[model samples]
Target: MTFSAFLWMTFGIFGTLAIFSFLYKDNPFYKFAEHLVVGVSAGYFVIILWHNGLTPNLFQRLADGDWYFLFLNSSKPWYLIPAILGAMMWTRFSAQYAWLSRWPMAMYIGIATGIAVPLEMANRINKQLFAMMEPIDFANFFGTQGFDLLDPTSGLSQLIVFVGAMCALIYFYFSKAHEGVFGRVATVGIYTLMIGFGASFGYTVMARISLFINRIQAIEAWRATGFDESNPEYHGGFPAVFWVILLGVVAYAIVEIYQHRNRPPQSEEPSA
Candidate 1:
């Protein structure tokens, strides 16, 4: 492997192991990895926001006056309103004029809510209502085409979803006392919610396991085939840096254990 690729792989391996060290205990290595990740992410986000967001949307529009070519002759001064509001948000940093920041904050919230309401209604509410309203014919439920009742894409599944949704909504209804039939339906809704939550948790665990497996595979590959000059498959040699980090952590742990064992015990004063 080239020097650059080898260097990057070394860093990646060290970073991965350092993060995994947290499983043992909270140590400097884990803290270093955590801080590095947070710092890198924050820096990268700032760069992306400036280059892809502000540079194109704010600066470019202001400089070129390209307001969708709607106003060819007139300058696009309307864009300045948002820019001013954004600047006003920084007033919160000042001790004397912190209240001025509330105006921009309120405006931002109002604008965001105004934009999100219709989108949420169309994409979430209306579409979900349409999906739940699918016809539940008993004939179709037992037909040759409906072999799998549990299949999510099947029409029968819609009936199951509609029932679950209705039950869940009933569980949230606090207008009247949940007694008799309503209480039973609400109990069914609780079961449905628990099942949903369990499935979600399982899916999340699987996703994390998949990521861990991928990282382990990469580490194994690196160890099996050191960067060989002749063979592309074995590009880099065993990482000495990883060994150094491992040894350093081991030494630190040993020292901590020794110190803990040998430290003087505290003496209590006589009771008052």
Candidate 2:
């Protein structure tokens, strides 16, 4: 068909194969794809910087000779502020001016750390606590309203979940010793937290598996000109695409094994 359609198909086929490269335990093909992704991302960032930061703001502001607007816009751009800060940042290149670099670095660090602590603590504690303590209706669980374990209103699973969440939070309190009453109880909470974390991890892994299955489905849906079984396009079940994936992976694994077999010997150097 058209070149654009062919290009799309080509990329799709190759991307699918690239993901399967994981089975080979990493190789040049996987590395090539990885570098391609990084290169494309860097190119995108350069284009964005040119349009948003450099072109409209710096260049245009300099062209218009507007000092206030120059901080944002420019045409024949002086770009003094960023240029100065950028120059200050490069002061690290000189032994004498290296300490000057610390001012900007400290400012960045102070602002970042200041904002992060409160937000991180609130997200970790308050949100999790309220979520764990939400309302659960019990009438649906046991058929009879009296003794239903599954219904959140019945307070069985919810109690366990709540205890687990609270205990887990307490496990992080380092100011007091865990050997005391609260600390002993907090240890049990640690178990609950581990269970919760494990469940979340399992869910995330399943989501990745679902994405992998979706890619396979996409490849299966691609149609071409193959009316008869004897045609070259028939390719048994899948197309030549499957073999490329299967062999690419096999080749990668073989290379990995060979590399490992040829690894250099470890040294037994003394530590200070």
Candidate 3:
């Protein structure tokens, strides 16, 4: 293996093991891995935002204007408003001018909320209402079978969805007391809600399991390159790096254990 590739693999193996070490207990290795990832991601995203966001949208547009004119000659002079607001956010670092930062923050939130509310209403409320209003195809409900509730597009499935939605809505209606028929419908609503939640939780757990499997696969891939010197992919440095890290960790653990065992115990004062 090339030296560069070997170095990358070594770092990968160390990082993977370091993160996994958290399962045993919190340690310097895990902290190092976590901080390294956070620091790298922060720096990476800063550069990405500068290049993809500010450089093109703001800087490039004002590039043609003279500095003396404050970029007023630029075609999109209005962009300066947002640029100034962004700059104003830095006032948060100043003790006296910290209040200035709130203006930009408020503006950001106000604009964001104004844009978000309508979109959310359209997506979550309007679309769902439309979906429930759709006519069920009872003629082809079974789709060549006696029952096909599993098919989302089937009439039976759509009918169940409509009924469950109504029941769930009724459960949230606090005006009428839940008793008799209303209580039974509300109970059905509880079942529907639990089923939805369980399905979502199951999907999330499966996703996490898939990620763990991927990590194991990566480790296996690295190990598949046999340790034999005769193998083309084999590198002496790979095994050397692994052993060095492993021994270092083991030695540190031994030192800690020895110190803990040999150290004098502290005496407590008599209770008042």
Candidate 4:
């Protein structure tokens, strides 16, 4: 492999191993990886926002100097408002004028909430209401003439969903005390909620597992580039670097264990 590609691959391998090393215990490797990720992500997003957001939408629109875009004579003078507000956010660094930052923050929240509320109502509330209101097709209950229990669009699935939603809503009714038939329905509602939560949790776990698998695949791919002198991807120096890093990590772990074993224990202080 090219030297640049090898260097990047080595970094990626080290980062993957460093993250997995957390299973052993919280150590310097994990901390370094974590901090490196956080630092790089922060800087990357800042550059992205500046270039993709501010540069195009604000700076470019107020081009041709136009009194440095401060005299309200630019083609899109309205862009100056957001730019000034963005600049005002920097006032947070100064104790004397820190309160000035609140104006921009409050305006941003107000505008965001105004935009989000209607979209959320339409997507989450209205769409769900419409779905529940639709008639269940019993003819296609078994999924187009076959016994497909997993088909969410089936009549049986729709009925169960309707009943579960109603029962779940009833369970939240504090005006009436739960007893007899009411209590039983509420219990069913709780079970349905548990099932939903469990399914969601399982899906999240599977996503994490998929991510782990991808990382493993990357490591495997890196290792597949064997040290064959005749091969185009051969790199004799990388294997040595990899071994050095591995040995250094092993040595660090051994030292940490030794220190913990020989360290003196602290005595508890007497109560006043």
User: What is the C-alpha local distance difference test score of candidate 2?
Assistant: 0.70
lDDT of 4: 0.87
lDDT of 4 by residue, 211-242 (tens): 99999899877776644466678877868767
Candidate 4 deviant stretches above 4 angstroms: 66-71, 94-99, 226-231, 265-272
TM-scores of the models, in the given order?
0.81, 0.57, 0.86, 0.87
Error of 3 at 37 (Å): 2.2
Off by over 4 Å in 2: 61-63, 66-79, 93-96, 114-162, 169-187, 221-272
lDDT-better candidate, 2 vs 4: 4
For model 4 the local lDDT of residue 182 reads 98
Each prediction's total of clashing residue pairs, residues at least 3 apart in sequence or on different chains, is 7, 12, 0, 1
lDDT string for model 3 (1-272, tens) is 77567667767877988998999999888999999999999999999999999999999998988789999988888889999999999999999999999999999999999999999999999998999988998887865466766787788888899999999988999899999999999989989999999999999999999988988887776675525566688876677766776799899889989998999987697657
Which segments of candidate 3 are over 4 A away from where they belong? Answer: 73-76, 144-146, 225-232, 266-272
Residue 139, candidate 1: C-alpha displacement in angstroms: 5.0
When sorted by TM-score, best at the front, the candidate numbers are 4, 3, 1, 2
